[model samples]
Target: MAALDEIQTIVILMQENRSFDHMLGHLSLEGLLPDVDGLRQEDMELTTYANEYRNRFYWPFLIQDEASVIRDPPHSRHLVQVQMARSSSGKKFRMSGFVDSYIQYTQHQTEHPPPMGYFDSRGAWMTSFLARQYCVCDRWFTPLPSDTQPNRCMAFTGTTLIDDTDSRLIPHREHVFDWLNARGVRWRVYHDGPPFFLLFGRFHELVGMKYRPFSELAHDIQHEDPGQAPQVIFLEPRYFDFFWSDEPANCNHPLALVCHGERLLHRVYTALTCNPEKWARTLFIHTYDEHGGFFDHVPPLPIENPPPPGADFTEGFKTTGPRVPGLLVSPWVQPGKAFHGNLDHTSMLQLLAEKFGSGPEDYSASVNHRRAQRIRSLSEALADAPALRPIPTRAPEPCPPMPSMKRQPRAPNERAFQKAALELLQHEGPIATAAKYPDLVGAPLTP
Candidate 1:
């Protein structure tokens, strides 16, 4: 096997929610703006509702007693968005509200809201890791107007809500996996459950997929060969009751985002650094699918163009949510630097396609076509100096195990939340869902 420095594998870990500023603003270590300053005055007012409620109104709930009640009332969906937008009123764009707000807008009805705060905090763990260890894109944004499926598509396919609105629906165009397959690149998608979109339909023809359950992730990594290991890897967390697991000790507990951050750092550090042959050449990119209605000050860039081919959604789309957080960690990029360049999910696809020699057809031709001077590369995000050698030979401390969780039979209210979400998904279908949900905006599911 070649030395770790010689290999160029890219491992991308994309989580679900959180805007760039909400999570990173408090990162005092980066000096990225510890306390609000003249330039950082654009931060969202995290304390807007703090005085009204002592318990910290991190997630917006229409009724004061939201945590105990899972019942998503008919108006809850609409109100969720309104409340989220209000919560993030300090953020830059008026259109960028919380997820529930957008959900109400897209569904054209009020409905139940899911556990936003719990999921976001968990996802931030991955983002914080990238910030501490690698280069961060402070100005990075999402290209699509709304939520997970389309934004994820942008990461892999380099296009917006073009083919399927629902993430569950498969796309017609080939994805990054196709390019990797054609190049004979070894890659895998590691998830707590079943593989998501990147592994669907014809796309599967191009890449390998595996279901290791959270319990098996580390064990699987132990057996990997530097040369035989996947060239690219993706990690997705499972969400249930604002917690990935149902362990009482770990259930819906409040924690400093940094705590979660440390955990994620340990995982990536081990995955790459442990295998001496894979550390140097590996590029690990961490980002969120969309901002889940967190307050952020930056507004989405104006995209005045028709949706690209194979795209089947409305155009002139605007996410209207606060800025989602993004980070890039690689040997080629500088450390402790914040890139203020304007980027969205499409940029991730652009980066991967270029690095792996994929064609532009997989992405929006408009963005990819203007490669002359317009194309911005993440190579600048690489660390100025390569990671120091003598890859430490520490006894393999196991990847932090996820607390065993039991999906207890859904409670009455929990069932309501799921039903509302399913109905919302069914009504909106795939394409509409992709177009409507943006980071930092909340959407309520309707019955």
Candidate 2:
């Protein structure tokens, strides 16, 4: 049998707005996984020089938990350029200026900006536990430096013709769901609420059949026939964008507590691992969509061949963004192993293409060019370890109780992608859009 045949299920859970250094950098401090590429003694602290009005230096301190962050830092394309501080020659990325950029866009001034902070394993227990028990990709970067939607577009369609995360509906492109459907691969998207796939109008049809509520995941795992179960699954945590109402917003966006997301992870992991037969053949992956303007020590790798331009984006795409947390949980991966190969959101597409073959050759030109980049495949991590490791018996740490909702004014730097998405819904008619996104019912479009 082919190597791909050995795996019967692939589950991907993509979270939001965290950098590798911000989330898992301190993993090494625990000393459980010594070989992992995590924070060292010298890396515990980082300093950024700023001269907004006078010469000043800012040093990053370790944040105790995620809830302490009051404001969502600006992560627009222009602001990210300031954060990276690429050299004039365009050959070197300095990875400085975070404090300066945060201060420049923030409406409220504070003595300490949240952008200049990192979290240790204590606060990110689920992420740390998953990384320690399976594989962590230290070199995995987001395909773009912008905000949520663009990098998410890269993950779903293997290209982000548009650069920002405005509220506009994505242009018609070959989505991963379409690819899986074409190849006769069974797939499903289990989301806590309104599915992100709804953002793309083209995927509306599949939403009814393949999309499901989060509750159904556990039931399906326990009762669905193993042969008929979805071969590919995309799990979505409760997105923080819908937090205006009383709901568990567990996607781990800056405004929400990380503990909520950790609880979701624990539930997902328990559901998948409960059955040994299914667990042995399943490849579970957890990753972040983008760095969300957090501090990452490693600079993005340059992309030689940018994706073909779209109507919205004439400049084309170039350069991967900062490293984000990537964990591959599988029995096939040896415990404590770290994969350092360069990877990004498109790497998921590359792996799918390798396993199921690329969909219709003419489906998408931009996707074809991205494939030509020869990105590393997720399957590569399993090549060295042919035998399965023992299933984990320990339970994840208990998550703290959800805190009270403290409504705050929306950030002034809301990205264009979010605005565009909301506009698309409005165009469809506000009443109907309100039925789907209740938070935006009476909400003003103006920031």
Candidate 3:
């Protein structure tokens, strides 16, 4: 194993709802890199049948310039089964039912479903640049076969006791923050708006002190005493809600334009790499929480350990969800390298446990045991890699003009994560005020 001392800071930026193939599968086609497990000519030409006309719909070639997707695909538990074409026996995943699932979800209203679409490297230049310059993991999957909240919970704590994305506060569970705190490992959550950590109320005090506005991140990087800087930093992109606000969401939710996200990646990369000394000692990771109902050809593997014996074992999380983009950025990584190891959200926890000793074993014994047996630590990627000087990166293109917001109903498929986020603000406190700025008092809650 490589010495943890080589890397001083670890930064994670998790965006929303994009599959690996959806975003970066065209890297090879674009001549960016040759060995990446990306889309092939046959893959691009595959078709799925829709019942409407018994029509054979050819998979659309990569869409390079579109900002927001035309339609949000359904990703709820029931829909995922349809998307994967999971057999009734639960032993086979045919990976052939996406188009049919989309049609059913939209009630056959949309003749063309966006889930069948993909993006070439041109659509996600920043991601491609990072993957080309560092390492791209093609086999990374989300921990659970569910939506945002549970998968995110798995990233934070080694379990998601809850199975679905219902609009409610997350139940208290052992979190990585508690582990880091016990071991004296410094960490911080930086956000452009409401930090997602607020969703887990158990760590409210920790979130309050460690959570800082994204604006302060650059300043902290430049001015803070090296010894005082946080060892682990999580950057939360601004999330889009129905409420009127000046900041356009950059989290890349299906409804928001992706250009904003590209600019965000630029901001984060520039700030972290500006200082050579800091850049050399830092390792930044970029990934998505889940595939967000996108089409992925590879079937997720089954895990030996499911969530403990009791909590929602009915739809056991034995198998990981669809593949999502995972990039490891650092001066140490070899350019154009692609790691094919099996990794999921808990792999991060495994890495943290290795770097800083695992904390409070009794906090969630079953979950911890399951994590130990299943998740693969990502530290292996850093092994035997020689550190190099920071490479210069081009400035991200300017964002497209903002689209007009219209009074509309809240997306029917909107994740409960967003609703819980807004609910976090209903409480009367300093945290509440900071989270719920530009009051949404007049805005219709459903819209």
Candidate 4:
């Protein structure tokens, strides 16, 4: 393993749904990265990756106005099963069912489903710029073939108790935070609103110093003591459930303006680079939790293991979910290359083990199973020494305004988060929970 000790801190900013093909596929379509496994012209011309619905086949088309709000695609467990179109071979897939799956959710609005759309470099300016200037992992798949919660569960815990975004306190073994804590690895969360961890428990530290607002990240990056700095920092964007808040959701969830996520990326990157010496010692990872029902050409590698007994999901997944865009930014990585080694969300855990634990298997037994399956870690993306002497920082992306919502929780994930907060209220008492997560608990939730 590379001496990752030189990389003093690892920062992860996991944005919401949106796939590799939908977000950074333009890198391939525009011929900017000839070798990238993104969208292709022939796939469109020959209709190789087209999906048929309502007696019409929908091919990937460029979204001319990505700044405008679009509809969310279907991404539930059963819906993703339909979307994958698992072939008789079981290992391979037709990979052409996104449109059919989307219309399954929104039956009446069948004209031009969002899953069949692609964004140009200008549309996903921040992501495209980063991929071009850093390392883009084109083969990074969501660990689970389901909705946001389970996939995120796999990302953080290396396993899942639920397959769908069903509302409840997510029961588990050891979460990533617990694992880090047990090993004495300092970690922190910086969030724009209520941190997503509120969905898990009502621990005192979770509501205290362990979580801070994104507004404080710049100051911390510039001024925090190097030895006392957190080894792992998680950045949480404003989620869709906070639509009633003063700020618009910038997580790139469907129906959200894409530029908002770009602005958040710009904000975080600029802050990290403000101190070049600190930036050189930091590795920033920007990826999404799942595909959010967007179409991607790459089928997930075959899923082989079944969840342990008593998992909320008993039916074993046949494959990982679709490929999501993953970017690696640091002075240790060379720019302008696509790292094609197969990776899943657990790969990050493998990296943590290699860095701080005994070995790759030190993450968890579940994560070791993936390591046995050749799931590569983020460690491979780093060099033994810093490759880029003077790291390049891209120009700030000009973010436009997105239409705000002051309505009830309409999205499934939004309602799920609301439900988790409700559980927290029952466990921690109304006054305490509400004080901890004012906006999240103050807003009325539906049963």
lDDT of each: 0.46, 0.72, 0.71, 0.82
What does candidate 4's lDDT look like per residue over 226-255, in tens digits?
888899999999887655676788888877
Judge candidate 1 at residue 406 and give its lDDT. 45
Model 2 residue 389 CA deviation (Å) reads: 4.2
lDDT: worst 10-residue window of model 3: 45-54
lDDT of 2 by residue, 32-95 (tens): 6767666666644544222132365555557875565645777887888788888899888877
* lDDT (10s digit) by residue, model 1, range 243-346: 22332211111121233434544565566554544456777777666654444444555444346655666553433233566676655555556776666656
Best-fitting candidate, measured by TM-score? 4
TM-score of each: 0.62, 0.86, 0.88, 0.94
Residue 137 error, candidate 3, Å: 0.6
The segments of candidate 1 whose C-alpha lies over 4 angstroms from its true place after superposition are: 1-7, 28-129, 161-168, 202-223, 239-265, 318-322, 358-375, 387-447
Candidate 3 C-alpha error for residue 172, in Å? 3.7
Kindly report the root-mean-square deviation of model 1 from the true structure over all alpha carbons.
Answer: 10.1
Q: List model 3 lDDT by residue over 1-447, tens digit each.
A: 443667889999999888887788877667677787766665555442221224565354456556544456777767776777776898977666777777788776453567766776656878888888888988898877778878888888777777777655676477888878988989988878766665676434533668787878888887788799999999989775433545677888776777788889989998897777777778898999988888777787686545555565465655778889999888767778998887888777777777777432333554466456554567767646555544769678767776655334355323333454355455544355455333333434441
Candidate 3 local Cα displacement, residue 77, angstroms: 1.2
Candidate 4 lands at a TM-score of 0.94
